[model samples]
Target: MSNESVRVVLVNTTHPGNIGAVARAMKNMGQSELVLVAPRSFPDEQAVWRSVGAADILENATVVETLAEAVADCHFIVGTSARGRRIPWPTLDPRACARQVLERRNSGQQVALVFGREDRGLTNEELQICNLHLHIPSHEDYTSLNLAMAVQVVCYELRMLALEGSLSSDAQSEWDAPFATAENVERYLEHLEQTLIEIGFLDPVAPRQLMTRLRRLYGRMNLDEMELNILRGILTETQKSLHKSSTAK
Candidate 1:
């Protein structure tokens, strides 16, 4: 797997030093792409100081205002979380997470590993957008980990798996269609929501967890490009029928 295919994403990072240290960790593991989402401060002295010899990583990092902008092109997204949520997402340990990332990378998929702030992990809404959740199994007595350390743990796992060469050369060789990108998935979801509202199936006033559950369902499916287009076409046909019915009435 080419290391450049995988991106390390930090969301709302508060400390520049942590960003620098994460750069160092990524450099050690042969990963070069870094994405910062709404970081408090970037290109600061503290970040440069911590990055040390890996200044190139800091220089080349992409800074964006939102996570959606950061990973819109990525086909697979892995979110890091430490705490439980009201609605549990599909969770994978570090090794398993690394394995999956490597496997996808082998298939020429662009992947992003998303990390949250130091104070608290990813928000429920942010985590929902991810295709899979990654949780590091730490001791119960002291579960808290430094932001840089958490990133290092996951990066190390990826490096180890790559060096071992345990995975197949082409993980998705048999699969004919490419997986849909994050942007396309988001569009499909928006269309689905609008169609549901138009049909009076989902009351936008209350809404509840219908959309969240649907996001979870689709995230698990990892729908390919063809699959996503098929779903979108269905939504379009449904909307047209609704329009026809209203006109007839």
Candidate 2:
């Protein structure tokens, strides 16, 4: 994985200091790209002041209107969320998530790690866009992590993974396989959901909850393209079988 391809994004940050601290964290881990989506007070003197020696990151930071714009081209998107919400996305520890990101990265895919607002963290809707949710394990009594600290933890893991080459042998083997792509997985997911809806397994009127759960379940497994295609084929056959049964009846 190229060190230059991972992007760290802060969404709707209300604190300039946190933004500065995030820049510092990214720099500490050799990460350069820092993107801010709709931050409250950018270009504030305080942000630069807090950046300290990492001013280059702050200076080169990209400010955008939406998170979608920030991560549109990224092949992998991971969202940091501390609190478990109603959404069904599978949560991963920072180390594990970093491994998954690095694997996709080794295939020459651009990856983005997204952090949300400092106070409330990411919204359920925002979390939905991410392929996975990353949570930092902390003392159960006091699990709320400062936004900058969370960024630091995630960046630290990524830096360590990149430097140490901890990838499993299986993962290394898949690195050479060109059969499955992220786009294929996404299309297969869409087809599976449609099949579920058609088979009365999903209610079209209130689909978000179930789909979110299913998304989380599948995201946790991190299915490669070939696996995703196999799943899609199963769904297609099931759909055909159901159709035949209804016609015969």
lDDT scores for all predictions?
0.90, 0.85
lDDT value, candidate 1, whole model:
0.90
Scored against the true structure, residue 25 in model 1 reaches a CA lDDT of: 86
How far in Å is the alpha carbon of 155 misplaced in model 1?
0.9
Tens-place lDDT digits, model 1, residues 1-249:
475358999999999999999999889878889999989998889999998888999999999999899999998999998867788888999999998988888788899999998988888889988999999999989988888888888998987887776556776756889999999999999999999999899999999999999999988887899999999999999999989999999
Off by over 4 Å in 1: 1-5, 166-249
Backbone clash tally for model 2? 0
Q: For model 2, what is the C-alpha lDDT against the true structure?
A: 0.85
Q: Give lDDT tens digits, candidate 2, residues 89-190.
A: 788999999899888888888899999887788888888889999888998999879988898888898887886755554644655345556677678779
Query: For candidate 2, what's the RMSD?
Result: 21.3
